[model samples]
Target: MQRDALSLSQYIVYRNGVPAGARGGLRNMFHRAFGAATFAGFWRHWNPIFGYVLGRYIYSPLQRVVPRPLALILTFVVCGAVHDLVTMAVRGAPAFFFVPWFVLLGTGVVLGRAVGLDLSGRPWVARAAANLAYVLACLAITLAGECFIW
Candidate 1:
């Protein structure tokens, strides 16, 4: 209750000091379909908790109708589309790399989650690997944006 501090809704949950609401650890609901780690991390990392709406409202329901793989793909597609629209609006031109960027992320989510689910008796490896993969994915997307987004 400090001054200038606003309270978060009860829906907000924390994981390892990071704000990844609603049981978003390695075994959280998001991990099952979205990926074991970092997929939801995009929003979770942001302090305002923007990812909450996307994961809870959009992602949750989408998973019910679509196949798991398709749901996974859709998740990134939604993310990409939103980003693309934002880029178009702000920059007044379509950078358009977000589609492929998010697609690549969806691929990483599937592969990383599969591997992370069972790290051959070493969970830390999966965590570290996932973190590394997320970092690399971000770097790749950023580089692509720099080159393509004019």
Candidate 2:
């Protein structure tokens, strides 16, 4: 069976689940992501544009061959590689920040899901703080790993 593909605009609207007038603005994205009650939900809300492409082209395909968790990690690593590539081009030097960072975040998602970690019962402020803490902790760990590597 053939699947119907949505245009980027439609995908953004569908992914964000926002009214057409809202257009998934940056502020809305930030609110949804940071306020998400689960790490997976945060990813679902983060950067709908990139998520659409990665979900459709990378993770979906890989999941058919590998396990879902592996696919998720690979998708994140691919995204980080793309970001690193752009940073390298602009800086005229190699950069290796995003890959490990994304890997840790992806792992967090998988483990968090495995543990049934959900903050939905918490206040919105608490949920947002937890999500932000997860992100910053990943960044700090990645920086430490990079320091060891260099």
Candidate 3:
């Protein structure tokens, strides 16, 4: 259970980090080519910066309280819950899709840790494997939920 939680948290952080990086890149592009204002660029990069700060100050501090996996799981569940609430309110989508995705993400983190996957060393392969695992796991979970879990 603990391990599961920790994995989830790690996955959440990673997912958020990717999009944040992309946003930051886009902002940088605009600033470089179009002479966008600092304030606008800052706003564009805010997500990544915010995620980094949260992981460093809040998430890291909280992680020490539990085993790595459990910590990840708890953090991810919270993140998933928040996403669900926001999506439901803002987009009127059912909150169910997040559950499976979070579960899959948690599983991926555990597997990666167990295998000692070095994402930085083998970027393309590592990302492909991780993402494939994530997608498959999520699909399976969602299918199960639709068939019986729910």
Q: Evaluated with lDDT, which candidate comes out highest?
A: 2
Q: Give the candidates in order of lDDT, highest first.
A: 2, 1, 3
Against the correct fold, how does model 1 do in TM-score?
A: 0.58
Better of 2 and 3 by TM-score: 2
Candidate numbers, best TM-score first, in rank order: 2, 1, 3
lDDT of 3 by residue, 1-150 (tens): 222344434433443433434555544433332221222222123344444444555456678997777766555565566667888999886766675566565656665667765444444444445555555766787677777756
The weakest ten consecutive residues by lDDT in model 3 span: 35-44
Candidate 2 deviant stretches above 4 angstroms: 1-6, 17-24
Residue clash pairs of candidate 3: 2-69, 2-70, 3-69, 3-70, 5-72, 5-73, 6-69, 6-72, 6-73, 9-72
Model 1 backbone overlap count? 1
Q: What TM-score number comes out for model 3? A: 0.54
The CA lDDT at 99 in model 1 is 69
Worst 10 residues of 1 by lDDT: 1-10
lDDT of 2 by residue, 29-119 (tens): 8888899999999998788888878888999899999999999999999999999999999999999999999999999999999999999
Of 1 and 2, which scores higher on lDDT? 2
* TM-score of predicted structure 2: 0.90
Error of 1 at 102 (Å): 1.3
